[model samples]
Target chain A: MTEEIIIAGFGGQGVLSMGKILAYSGIMEDKEVTWFPSYGPEMRGGTANVTVILSDTRISSPVLHEFDTAIILNQQSMDKFEKAVKPGGVLLYDPNGVIHPPTRKDIRIYKVEGTRAAVEMGNPKVFNMIVLGGYLKVKPVINLANVERGLQKSLPERHHKLIPLNLEAIRKGGEILEAN
Target chain B: MGELRLMKGNEVLAEAAVRCGCDGYFGYPITPQSEVMETLMELRPWETTGMVVLQAESEVASINMVYGAAATGKRAMTSSSSPGVSLMQEGISYIAGAELPCLIVNVQRGGPGLGTIQPSQADYFQTTKGGGHGDYRLITLAPASVQEMHDFVELAFDLAFKYRNPAMILTDGALGQMMEKVELADQKPRWTREEILARSGSWATTGKTPDRQRNVVTSLELDSEKMEQNNIRLQAKYQQIEENEVRYEEILCDDAEYLMVAFGTSSRVCQKALEVLREQGVKVGLLRPITLWPFPSKVIGEMARKVKGILVVEMSAGQMVEDVKLAVFDACCCVPVAYTGRMGGILPSPGEVVEAFEQKLLKR
Candidate 1:
C-alpha cells in the first residue's frame, strides 16, 4: 500500500536502469508496479528521471508528483529533484559526482559515491548495480534475493559471468554506505 | 504466474506474440514503434519456433506482407507509429476491401507532421474513423497497462478473426518505452494453424483447384451493384462490432456529479485524477474506452442519465469528444461534455487533469 519512488540523474548515469531494477523487484514480490522514464529530447545529457510505483493493490497512476524515496546521481539531478522529495521521506545522492546538496532536514540523505564505488570494483558501468544494491537495503520494496535473480534473467547468457560482479558492486555499496 | 523481469514494452509485445505462437510478423523502423521490429529481429522467431519475422523496406511493404500472410488464415501483424501508419493506410484499405483478418499496432507519437519522438494519442480519428477510404472500421484497442499489452495481442487476433477484419492495437510511446510486469497466459489451449486454415480456406486463395473455380482475391470489381453489396456487407459487419463487441471500463459514475473519459495511457492518468480528486472530496468519475472504434458511446450515454457533466480527457486535441457529443446529442441536461488535453508526447499530470475535471465538470 506504499506510494512511489523517483530516481533521477544526468543521462548515461543509468538512473532509469536502476529504477527498472526496483520495478522488477517490486513485481517479483507480488506488488503492482509501473515505471516511467523521460524519453526523447529530455534524455540527451539533460536531466533524466524515472517514476516507479509499487503497491499492494492495483496501480492507478504511474505518474508521481512527489516521492517516498528520491535518488539522484548528479548535481543537476539534485538541483532539480531535491525539493520534490516527499516531506518526511528518504533521499540518496551520489557522493562522487554531486556538488550541490539539498538543505532539507526532513528527509534522510544517503551519500554513496556510486560511480567511484563501481570504478573501485573495476567496472564503472556497474554503477547501476551499486545504486541497485543501495536501493534494496534502503527500501524493502522487494527481496534482495529476488532482485539478483531478476538481474540474472534479464542479462544475456553471454553476460552471465558478470552477474557476480554486479552483485559484488551492490554488496560493496550496501556495506560502504551502512558503515558510514 | 512467473517471476518479474525488466523488459521494455515493445520487447514484451514481441515476446507475447512469439509465446502466443503468432504465425507472422512484418514491420519497418519507426520511432517509438521501432522497438517492435528490433525485438522481433533479435528474437529470430523462425530459428526458434517456426515463427516468421520479416523486416520490410517500407511501411507499405510491411502492411502488404501482413495482408498476404493474413489471407492464409494465419495470425499476422505489422506495427508502426503515426507517420508510418499514414503510409500504411493504402494497404489497410486493400486489406479491408479484401476482408482479410490482420492485427496492426500503432505506437503513436506526436504528429500531423514529423512530431518528435515522444508519446502521443493524436491518431484517434485516423484510427477509428477510417484512415483509408470507403466505409470500414478497424477494431481499435487502446491498452492502459503493460499487462494489457500482453493480453490484448490474443484479444486482437480473436476479434480480427471473429469478424474477418483488420484490428489495431492503439498504444502510445509511453506504453511502448516503459517497463512493467506481464504475467503471460497459459499456452496449452492455443489455436493451431490446422484449425484456423480449415475454417478460413473456403473463401481464401490457397491454391488453384481443378474441382473448383480459380481462387482469386481482389477488392476491385467491375460491377457497381456488387460493389454496393460489398460496402453494405462491410457496413453490416461494422454494425455487429458496434452493437456486440464494444468494451469499456467505468469508475464510480452512477453517483458521480462529474465524469472523465480517456483511453490508453491518458486513461491511466485520469485514474490518478480520480484518486486525488476523491481525496479532496470531489465527485469525479473516469470512463475508459478499451475499444476505440466502438467508442463506448452507449455506456457513456447511460452514465449521462445520472451525471450532471462529463469531461473528455485525451492525449489528443478533442477527437473523441466529438463522439461524446454525438452520443448524447449535446443534451441540455447538465450532462455537458467538456474537453482538455495536450498534443504529441506531453502527458498532463494527475493534478492538471484533476484541475480540468473540477473546473469544467464540477464548477461550471
Candidate 2:
C-alpha cells in the first residue's frame, strides 16, 4: 500500500517534525518513506509544508501535486491543500486559527482541537502529536506501537523523557477528533 | 551491512564523506545546501576521524582550498548551491587543468542571479558543458534519490581519483532537503600519508623525495605548444572517460514507443509520469542519466532509432535537450525530440509531463 501525505502549518507548529516521526515509523515497519519539505524563506515564520510518502515499493517522486491525505494545522495550509486532496482521501486539520474550514464534498474531513488540547496538557509543543494522533485514529495506517518507536528514534536522547507526554497528547487528540 | 537511517540528502552527503574516509571538507554556507557544512561541523569529524572540516570565508576560497588539498593527493571536497557554485567556476577550471582529484557538489537552486532558494536543475548546462572557462569536463553524477546521494559520494571520489580529474554530484534543493531511508556505508579509515604517497605519489606534490623527481602541481604553461599539448591530453582523457564511465538507467524501454530523457529531480518526476501514462496504455519509458558529463549519448542514440519520439524533461528552459538532439543526430535518426520544463525552481508535475508528451509527441 502507498500513502502520499502532506502536513502543512506554521513553521513552529511541528509540521516537519510530525512528518519526520511518521516517516521514522514507516521505516520501523520496513516501509519505504520520503519526507520532502518546502524549505527556504517560507519556513522562516511563514507557512511551511512537508510531503511525506510511505509505500511498500520504491517511492517514485518526492514532490507531488496531489495527496492521499492532507494534515493541515493553519488556515493558510487548509486553503492551500484542501483542493489538493484526492477524492475519497482524508483531510485532518486543527481548527485553532482557521477562519474558513475545508468544504470538500469528495474527501473525508476531521477536526482536532490540537492547540486547545496541547494548552490543556500544559505543553503547546505537543500540538502536532495530537493532530497526528487524530490522523492515526482516522486512517489507522500505522499502529501506535510503531509511532512510539518512531518518536524514540526521531527525538534526541535528551528529549526521550517527553515521549510519554507526546504519547499522552496523541491519545488525547484521538478522543477529541470531530467529524466535519 | 551498513548502518541504516533516515536522513536528508545534504546531511547524508556529509555523513557519507566522513564514512568514506574523506580527508577534508571546505565549504561556505548557502541556502538549500548549508546543511552539508552544518552537519559536518556538528559531526565533528575532525575530532573523531581526524578529518578536517572548515568553513571558508567565501565560495572561491572554499574551492581553492579543495584544490590545494587535492593537489597533495588528499580526498578533499566542497559543496554549494547555484550562485555559490558559479563563484567557484574559475577554481574548478584550474582544478580540471591541473588534473587534480577532488569532489564538488552543487545542490542546485534556481538562478539567473540569486533567483530563488527552491530546487531546480538549471545548472545542467553549467555543470555538464563546462561552467568554468577553457575546455574541461567534470565527471558529473546526478542523484535522483537520497540513497543515490549517499552512494555517489564514494563513487564520485573513486572516479575523480581514478581519472585524476575533478568530479561533481549534481543534485538540487529538493533532494538536499528531502529525507529518506539510506543504508550508509561503513566507516573507512582516512588514508595515511604513506598511503597517499603510494596511491598518488606519481603526480601528487606530496614531498620531494630522494628516489624520484620533485612533483610540481600547476595548470600554468607559458609555452604555447606545451599548452596545446596539455589541452590535447585533457581532451583525450575526457574521451577515455566518455568511453568507460558513462552510467544511466533505463526503465520500461524494451517495448516503449516514446522515451523521456531526464536526470536528477526531473527523472524522479518522469518515473511517476511513466507509471501514470502506462496505466493509460501510453507506451512511454524513462531514461535517467546517472552520469551527466558522459551524457549517455551512445545509448540515447540507440534508443532514438527505436522510439518514435523523445521527450526531454528538465527544470530548465532547455539544456539536456540539446544533448538528446545531438544524440539523435549522431545516430542519423529523424525522430522528433520535444522539450518541456519548468524554470526558476518550479518543478513540473507528473500530470504536466504526461500532457506535454501527449501534446508534443502523440498529437504531432
Candidate 3:
C-alpha cells in the first residue's frame, strides 16, 4: 500500500511538522517513508510545502504534481494546490486561517478550525497534532495509541512533558470532528 | 546472503569499510554524508580492533592522514561531499603520484560552488579524468543503491590495493540520505600484515633498516629525467587498470536501438525508465559506468558500431557526456550529444528520463 500527502502553508504555520509527524509514524509502523521538503527559492516564504510518501515499497521520485490528500493551512496554499488534487481526493482546510475555499466541482472538502482547536487544548504547538487526529479519524492507517507513542518517540527527553498535552489535543480534535 | 536491514547509504559504506578491515577513517563533517561520520562514531570499532577514527580540521588534513596510514600498507579511507572532495584534490593527486592505496568516498552534492544540500551526480568528469593533475587515474566506483554502497566498498579497496592507486566511491545525497533494505555481505579473508608489507614495502618510509636502504613516499622528482620515468610508471599502471578494472552494468540491451548513459542516482532513475519503455515495446537499454575512470571506453567504443544514438542523462550541465564523446571519438554512429540534465539536488524523474528516450528513439 502507498499513501502520499502534501502539507502546505506559509513558513511558521507548522505545515512541515505535519509532514514530519506522518513520516515518523510510518517509520514506527515499519513502513518505507521519505520526507522531502521543496527546496530552493520556492521555500523563500511566499509558500512552503513538504511531500511525505509512505509505502510498503521504495519511493522513486520526491516530486509530486498532485497528492492523495492536501492539508492546506493558508489562502496561498489552497489557491496553489487545490486544483492539483486528484478527482475525489480530500482537502483538509484550516477554516480559522484560510479565508479562501475551493470552488472545484469534484472533491470532499473539510474545513475545520485546526488552529483554534489546538489553542483550545492549551498548546498552540499541537496544531500539527490536531491535524493528525483528523487524519487518523479519516484514514486509520494505524491506531491512535501508535501515533501517541510516535509523538513521544519523536521528541527529545527535554520536551517529554509536551506529549500529554499533544495527546489531549488529538483527542479534543477528534471530538471537534465528532461534533461537526 | 542474509536478512535485510534498513540503513542509509552512507551507513552502509561505513559498515562495509569496517567489515573490509579498513585500518582508519579520517573525515570531517559535511552534509549529505554526515551520517557516514555519525555511523563510524557510533560504531566505536576502536574499542576492540585498533581501527583509528579521527575528525580532521579539513579535507586536506584527512587525505594527508590517509596518505600516512596507506604508507603503513594498511587499508585506509576518507569520505566527503563535492566541495570537500574538491579541496582534497591536491592530496588525492599526491596519493596517486606516490602510489598509495586508499579509498575516497564522494557523496556528491550539486556544485560549481556551495550549490545546495541535495543529491547530484555532477562530479563525473572530475572523477573520471584526472581532476587533481598530471596524467593519472583513480579507480572510481558509482553505486546505484544502498545495497551497492555496502557491496562496492570491498571492491574499491581491493582494486586500490591491487593497483597501488587511490579508489573513489562516487555517490550523491539521494543515495546517501535514502534508507533502504540492504543485505550485508559475509566477511572474507583480508591481507595479512606480511602480505601488505610485501605489496607496499618498496617505498613506504617505514624507517631505514641496517640491511636495506631508506624509503620515501613522495611525488617530488627534482630531475626532469626522474619525473619522466615517474610519469611513465604511472602511465603503465593506468594502462593495466584500463585493461583489467573496467567495471560497468548493462541492462536490457539485447535489441536496444538507443542506450541511456547515466551513473549514480541518475542511473537508478534511468533503470526505472528502461523498464517502463520496454513495457511500451521500446527497445531501450542502459550502460551504467560502475568505474567512471577507466571510462568504460571499450564498451562505448564497441557500442558506437552498433546503436543508432546514445542518450546521455546527467544531473549537471553535460559533464560526463564529454567523457562519453571522448570515449567514442570519430566512431560516432549516432547523435551522441543528446543530453537531459537538471542542476544541484534537483533529480530528473523517471518520467522525464522516459520522455528523453521516447523523444530520441520511440518517436523517431
Q: What's the TM-score of chain A alone for every prediction?
A: 0.91, 0.97, 0.89
Candidate 3 reaches a DockQ of 0.17
Query: Which candidate comes out best when scored by lDDT?
Result: 2
Q: Mind giving the per-residue lDDT tens digits that candidate 3 earns over B296-335? A: 8778777767777788989998898887887778565445
Report the alpha-carbon TM-score of model 1 versus the true structure: 0.93
- How big is the positional error of residue B36 in model 3, measured in Å on the Cα after superposition? 3.6
DockQ of candidate 2? 0.84
Docking class of 1: medium
TM-score of chain A of 2: 0.97
Give interface RMSD, every candidate, in order: 1.3, 0.8, 3.8
Question: Lowest-scoring 10 consecutive residues by lDDT in candidate 3 chain B?
Answer: B328-337
Error of 2 at A44 (Å): 4.8
DockQ of 1: 0.69
In order, the Cα lDDT scores of the candidates are 0.82, 0.94, 0.79
By summed lDDT, which 10 consecutive residues of candidate 1 chain A come out lowest?
A171-180
Name the runs in model 1 displaced over 4 angstroms: A41-46, A178-180, B2-4, B186-194, B330-334
User: How much is A123 displaced in model 1, in angstroms?
Assistant: 3.4
In CAPRI terms, model 3 is classed as incorrect
Between which residue pairs do clashes occur in model 3? none
- Higher-ranked by TM-score: 2 or 3: 2
Clash statistics: count for each candidate: 2, 0, 0
Give the C-alpha lDDT of model 3. 0.79
